[model samples]
Target: MTAPGLFVSFEGIDGSGKSTQARLLAETLRARDRDVVLTREPGGSPGAEEIRALVLQGDPDRWSAQTELLLFTAARRDHLERTIRPALAAGRIVICDRFADSTRMYQGLSRGDLRPAVDQLHDLMIGTEPDLTFLIDMDPGQGLARAKSRATAEERFEDFGLDLQTRMRAGFLALAREFPDRIRVIDGNRAKAAVAADVLAVLEAELS
Candidate 1:
């Protein structure tokens, strides 16, 4: 029987460079002859991608915390069914840019005190968690500046400004503390190459 696959996730506030790091890790692993599926949350499947556009574009107030939670859960369910589960079942490494922890922060703590609802919904509708999660920690001010430089349509969350990013950073750190064994915190206030190196080292240690 094929060995079971590993499910990994990268998470941080906007502009924390988790996305870039995720891509870099996927590419490096592929070079080593590992089958890697690099995907993102609120996306990763066709249906989920559509939902991504809905949640990511538009104004910051486009959806309330409760509504956003439902939308995100729906997207995650579809992503799991159509993309993540199949990849892992086939023994392919699935590296996700963001996962449920993002929901726990963005929709759960950032917008309001909906963490319990987030956890309840997560347990009910989406029961899987990444085998390993990297919480890329950085200064919210710097990260927000970096994020706005891209000026992407997915600026809805970034538009919430530095205050939101600050809260998000704290929330992510708290999450890292909560799941100490599974979540590894990495300092992302360095050069991209440096951050990638730390990420690779951590992952290699895990694989070993």
Candidate 2:
């Protein structure tokens, strides 16, 4: 029988460099002859990609928090069914840019106190969690500045401004505390190479 696959996710506030790290890790693993699938939340599958455009490119207030939660859950369901599950079943490491933890922060805590609802919907529609998660921690001000510099259309969340970023940083930290065993916090204020090295070391330890 094939060994079970590993599910890994990288999460952080906008512009925290989690996306870059995810890509770098995927490249490194592939170089080592490991089968890896690099994917992202809200756009991992065809159906999820459609939902991503609807939720990410609009005005900050285009959808209410409750509405956004439902949309995200739907997207996650499709992503799991079409991308994540299949890869894991095939014994390939799945490295995702974001996962349910993002919904817990963005739709659950950022907009309002709808965490219970997010949890309920998550339990009902999507029930998978990453085996390991890297929470790249950085100052909200710097992170927001970096995010805006990119000027991507997915700036809807970044458009919320520094205050929201601050809150999100705190929320993600608290979440790390909540899931200390599975979530590893990394300081993202350093150079890209430094952060990437640290992440790789931690991941290698886990793999061993």
Candidate 3:
């Protein structure tokens, strides 16, 4: 039987390599004969997936900051009930691509409080934080350029504009500051293999 497991998250601005490292880590763990659940926020489950599409489908001209926050929170609640809580209870290591911190960075900081109603929306969702978070950090321009290089098309978050993304990157680092022990900052500009190795080292440490 699987023993009690750990909850870990990878987060960052777009193209900071959160998803790639998360998947790589999961695969590595599986290779080592450990049960690893790889998942993402705002779409880990059916209800959440719908919300995710709303959040990332288009540009800022279509979705407002507050709207994006609500969708994220909505999907998060679904993720909490459908994926995270269940996997943890079943004793499976859970590595999420993004979590509450993403919201705090994308919505909390970039949006500038979002005209007050956003606070209420956040309260309605954005539940407990992760047990451990790997903040894959890099320069905003570098991150965005990486994203563009890898992507065939842009998403809503991608079209958030440069200044907004810079603020979001700062926001992520600031959030990482609040939970120093829980959040580990990784140099995302490193080679993917090097970054994956760093993630593996951190996970091994966390697990041990």
The lDDT for every candidate, in the order shown, is 0.95, 0.94, 0.81
Worst-scoring 10-residue span by lDDT in model 3: 114-123
The alpha-carbon root-mean-square deviation between model 2 and the true structure, to one decimal in Å, is 1.6
lDDT of 3 at 203: 77
Cand. 2 Cα-lDDT: 0.94
Q: Work out the TM-score per prediction.
A: 0.98, 0.98, 0.90
Candidate 2 lDDT over 1-208, as tens digits, reads 1248889999999999999999999999999999999999888999999999999997899999999999999999999999999999999999999999999999899899999999999999887889999999989999999999997889899999999999999999999999998999999999999999999999999878
- Candidate 2 stretches greater than 4 Å from native: 1-3
Clashes of 1: 0
Error of 1 at 72 (Å): 0.4
- The residue ranges of model 1 lying beyond 4 angstroms of the native Cα positions read 1-3
Best model per lDDT: 1
